[model samples]
Target chain A: MAGAGMKDRQSRMSRPKRLRKTLKIPAIFFALSLAGLIWALLVDGSSDGLAALAAGSPLMALLWALLYRRQ
Target chain B: MSANMIKRMAWVHKWTSLICTIFLLMLCLTGLPLIFHDEIDDALNPSHWVPAHPDGAMLELDRILEIALQHRPDDVPIFMSFDTDRPVVNVTTGARPDVAATAMHFASFDRTSGDLVPPPDNGAAIMDFLLQIHTDLFLGLPGMLFLGAMGLIFLAAILSGILLYAPFMRKLDFGTVRASRSPRLKWLDYHNLLGVMTAAWVLVVGGTGVINTLAIPIIDFWKHTELADLIEPHGAPPSPVALHSLDDAMAKAKAAVSDMVLQFVAFPGASFSTDHHYAIYFHGKTPLTRQMTIPALIDARDGRFAGLRPMPWYVKTLALSQPLHFGDYGGLPLKIIWAVLDLITIIVLGSGLYLWLGKGGQRMDPAMEPLWQGPE
Candidate 1:
């Protein structure tokens, strides 16, 4: 079927994602998150404000992702 | 990865997320209000009551215990804890020394006058009700363990989600919304983005929650093993007819752990202590060591110092796990962040359900279904 041939072409276009590329930004966010979580626990007072911001990398990434390049 | 492998991961991701989605939603909803429970309680019950004798000499600990016992004539004393910021000491009494936490009655007394500190229970009942639902669903230990199992499943769903994410976004960039695409792809993209961003926090919260559910078992293990051995040399347990002065015992316990502040005291014959000694617990005033308690035992019969012991590593792990889960350690800012992340997680869960329901065909419900099977 002509439709079957098109489906085959589309499936062929589905390439496997590069592991390094996929994990690049997520890795950075994860490291920052871990550091921030520990920092909050190890100290207190005004530093806690800093710690919360650091732990909020994901939130930052999230904001950037949603608003990065609007169509 | 092979297409089949991706399909397998998808299978795992789908079912696990589907099974635990509802419970996770419940947890997130209940957990939102609980994060600021302290603030809510404070706002609801604005206290104007002060100590009876601000400048007068302090009331003896023994006298306070006596008054507490006199107030609850039929109940036996279990725990005595002091308020960190004020001159109030809380006494917890129950029908028996080894009763469950639910059965215990907690009342605060002014250290200056031995007068009962009244808490206008304005919104406290609501918070208590939410706590019960959040903790055990009112089913006690079994319910707690059941939630713990759910937490483990949630973790599985998270990890599997992460695994499947790599292949899902193979062609697309990070944070890709694909709003112009079909509804399924847009939601799928959103779910992946939110899932990855919120993974670490949810993992930490979920893991610590599992640890917390094991509290009763952990405490029981400590009591039956370490605590029992420590009290072994003191001979068989004996119920003291007239216990020695609690003030004297407190003084001895304080001297043993001079650097740490008093946390609480477990009376003799209590589950937290032997029938021979009063287990007086203390902790550092600093944020790091605040919850890590070191207990000093004092003989109840003659008020002798019975040595100080820092809690074993397991108990310390349990202690550290508490604040991580509660998000209470780093003050208000951290709590706000925790609340935001919790909301994001709720959205992620909802979107996941939406994506599945939109599959339309019943064929998609079983394993090896969904996106990968579209034309393969």
Candidate 2:
């Protein structure tokens, strides 16, 4: 239901309004970074690669904010 | 939040960040190379030497030690550590068991042939120099404690930054870099975005770095409290007697903790061992547990098996903080990411300084200007 509502909201919601609604993506990125750090610490082998990718979410966010929309 | 609250938070954020920015910059710079510590060692010291008898049966630990002692006739072993992936045993020796770090000498011997294996590292003195400065500014405990205090102030700045972030970001979207806007806004947005994006990582590294700075005191506390208590039950230590066989004691310790791999052996009278026991330390077989170790005590006199002494909670906390702060748990990719993040942190810090020096306060929105403006 929430996902459906978010989609319905997305149809008319501007990107800034969408972002300000709940600080959704940034919060998710934060969670991912923290989890990735702990995940990398806890496991080994190829999972480390996965963990690194997860931890690099902030870097991705940085790039996205730089390249995407400009006002 | 009220204007009064925002002003107070701004004042705090300004001062705290201003104070620790230089030191934190130094930390980030030095920490970049440290993240690739293993790779650096491997690159600097290209080791082409292989085991003399790779498949042949390895020599007894006792003979290896005897050969090591014979090589350094005047010195005694302080600590013995093993190489995980190679057939090498390293013995650190000093004139006496209790000696300062500078007075100690280290040598490695191949376990199979008992031949002397030259220690790795052609030269990395500059790296060590950077690491030392990063750790304590070469002021020893005082420097460490001072850095820890700086870390505390840095965290306060982060908190204030967060409180202040909400007001600036109220209208602006998350990570909205106004690069085409005036220089100040561009930098301000840059600072905010980078700071908030890297905030989680910064907190982790900063918190763990603070914990790491308290290592000496924590270990000393453990030694005096829990470690002392553990050894007390064994009664007052007896006079010096003929030392028992190390191989036998190792065998007993192996039998005691068969699942763990040997990390090192701290002999009696050494800093890490009691005066009457050979503390054989073992780390678990798995990756995470490998960071932690438990030591089994063997009576130095008769080599009787004593119970295992697991590190207390605080020591474990320190052990775990190491990899978290180092960003070494993952591989080279993680190190590269760590370096990039660190470099971006430098920009965030540098731009913050730039913003503060200019009309940052005077240029604030009219109402908020009075709140942030200081004597320029």
Candidate 3:
């Protein structure tokens, strides 16, 4: 039902709307970034151990890359 | 997932990742060679350390400690490590556990003759330099903290990237690399495919790395809490405590806890010690849990067992996570795997930047300035 509704909505929207929809991806990403920052400030200060965040970048890139690729 | 929210998040992820990508790339590159450090060192300087005759008598830890202290009576022995290749004993002594203190001493003794081995000309100075460079680029604690902040940002980018993945893939199939398209699209496709596939490994390494950075605080907390109780009511400020027999302490600690191997020792006033006890640290024998240490406080006064305190489960997990993140524990093969993964990471970082920049048609318009750059 939800998928059908989304399809209907997609058909109704203009072409630009489809491209613009992809843009929402970033906003959600940034909110998460904010949450991570707040958590780090509150819980643990910067240390070698916290390097996990930086280390996660490649994987993050890979993840997003897979999502955006054309069929 | 709202339009406004996605734009903001994309901005955050792009800028954050871009800022640290160069330095991170350097880290991965340098780290690649460093992973096989032990093997490289062995290959370059062979015969520096060789085993004594199998029939030769081995020196006891007690005698070695006495000899070590003879050179620096003021300082206390912090650690005693066995030589892997040679029958020599390496002893590290320090005036105090604080990093600021300079009155430190290191010595090696022959296992057979119990004679002091001369310092190697190439001392550990080079290794120490590499370590400092790897850790903070010689910027001390501030540099470390700065990198940590950057790491936090990078992590944000990662999680945000993951969230973005679902929507991006909503219309696309997994592993759809469009190599026939523009260079940017091809690279982008490769990046996504590689990144998602290695997601688990990356997350584990990254998350653990973040946790590992808290080592200083964790040790500080442990010292403040566990060691504090053991130190108070210092019996006469621990009168140069007649250096207790290390063998005995080892035996007692082993007897107290079965299925554990002795990792190292922390003398009184050392980083892991109280004023009145020599902390004998032991770690699990298993491959997975070997890094997790359990310290037994041995009263320096009488060489009697003082107390045994196991690390909290979280702390133990932290201990285990570090080696896993660094990929140094298993062997050279594992280090090779780690390096390959690191290279994959670099490609992913570069491809992501390419995709973000190649957006719309104009690659780099001077009119539209980059919002940010890496820390100066």
Q: How do the residues B55-155 of candidate 1 rate in per-residue lDDT, one tens digit apiece?
A: 88889988899899898989878899988888999999998788867788889999999999996588877888888888898898999999998888888
Evaluated against the true structure, the overall lDDT of model 1 is: 0.83
**CA RMSD of all predictions:** 4.3, 5.2, 9.2
Docking class of 3: incorrect
In candidate 2, stretches whose alpha carbon ends up further than 4 angstroms from where it belongs are A1-22, B96-103, B230-242, B360-362, B365-376
Give lDDT: candidate 1, residue B359. 79
Q: lDDT tens digits, residues B1-376, model 3?
A: 5655666776777788888777667666666667776766666555555445557877677887887788778876777766655677888877764443234667888877677876663435666566566667678666666666666777777776665554443333445666666676567557656655554455556666667666666776887876678867865646553666787877777787777776777777776777677788887755555777889888877779987898887678678767766777544444554676778888878888777778757664321221121101
lDDT of each: 0.83, 0.81, 0.63
- CAPRI band of model 1? acceptable
Chain A alone, TM-score per model: 0.68, 0.66, 0.42
The all-Cα superposition gives candidate 2 an RMSD in Å to the true structure of 5.2
Error of 2 at A45 (Å): 1.5
Error of 3 at B48 (Å): 6.4
Minimum summed lDDT over a 10-residue window in model 1 chain B is located at B362-371
Given candidate 2, what's the lDDT at residue B30? 88
